[model samples]
Target: MKAVLFGIFLLAAGNASASCDLVSAPCSTDSSGNTYIREQNLGGGYNTYRNGDLYSQTHQQLNGTYRETYSSGGYRTYYSDPNRGATYQGDPKGMAGR
Candidate 1:
């Protein structure tokens, strides 16, 4: 019974390390001097954030494709590899029409 309890404790501790919480927001000012808040995911591949007027998103797939979305209804997708430069897809104008 004691060994079983110890095993359970170790399993719980290891699972906790897989999850994370944001310590603070990432903020910045644009060229027009508009201040905004930004948040990033500590995990490299995928992250999501909510700012004052925009919702930002990012994802990096295992196949080396990166995607980002903006609240303005626009999204940019890119593919990165050693043999080629970053290729962009989707509507550069905005996703409002879609």
Candidate 2:
């Protein structure tokens, strides 16, 4: 029982470390040493920058839906309800999934 509990704790810790809460932190660094920064727009929404370049822009609608547009031309829409979200792939300029 003790070993099982320890394993569960370890798994949770690993997951927590791997995930980033963008609202709490202005920036986050991945394991690959790439840094992502979140800058709030004056009008609304936010722009995310990766390695000093535009990565994506997220805008929230009045209905609370989130639309994220990537610099690579890909875009995703997140709905408040589960399974209602949509993602569209765009040209990555020869890069796989960016």
Candidate 3:
């Protein structure tokens, strides 16, 4: 498991820091924290862990490639090369039934 600070820095909530793993990866994940986006802004991405569950998604251009992660777990990743492009369309995954 890797520790990654994702999304806009909402300040440190004491000890509830951000991390990256199988449940919370960097991609098109969503959150219950009002605003949601997976393009990994504010660095790369952020994952919220609680009750043995995870929620997050983020993407950013790294090394000339677009790195993306969906709520489809954290271990996997989809990267768009320098000239390639990709898209993900659907409701938020894992956290909500929608």
Candidate 4:
């Protein structure tokens, strides 16, 4: 599985240290001693929260595609059919298709 660093530097936000291993503790602390916790949602999805604030969330769509949304209003979608990915800033006009 790929490592998803839901930390301060996810988009070069800052220089906070974070380690995420899916099969491990599913938790990490940044440089400021803030702990981020990953918990599975009630249904089929997971959310990463920091200090009680929602940081990011990932959910699988009905089409089997995975979409991740961030607290900053950004979003990313992983398409398995085309084996590609796309990221958008705060709006659809800032889409960076890949």
RMSD, every candidate, angstroms? 13.2, 10.8, 12.8, 12.8
Give the Cα error of residue 89 in candidate 4, in Å.
23
Tens-digit per-residue lDDT, 15-81, candidate 3: 2333222324433334543323233337544443332344444444555444433445443344543
lDDT tens digits by residue: candidate 1, 1-98: 99999999998876543232222443433344443444445775433332234455666767777666666666766564211222211221223233
Write the residue-wise lDDT of candidate 4 on 37-91 in tens digits: 6667897676877655787777888988877787888777766411122332122
Taking all chains together, each candidate's TM-score versus the true structure is 0.39, 0.53, 0.25, 0.48
Q: Which stretches of candidate 3 lie above 4 Å from their native place?
A: 1-40, 44-54, 61-73, 81-86, 94-98
Better of 2 and 3 by lDDT: 2
> What root-mean-square deviation over C-alphas does model 3 reach?
12.8
Model 1 lDDT vs. the true structure?
A: 0.46
Task: Write the candidate numbers in order of decreasing TM-score.
Answer: 2, 4, 1, 3
Model 2 root mean square deviation, Cα atoms = 10.8
Q: Please estimate how well model 3 matches the true structure, expressed as its whole-model Cα lDDT.
A: 0.37
Q: Arrange candidates by lDDT, highest first: which order?
A: 2, 4, 1, 3
The candidate scoring highest on lDDT is: 2
Comparing candidate 1 with candidate 2, which one achieves the higher lDDT?
Answer: 2
Q: What TM-score should be assigned to candidate 1? A: 0.39
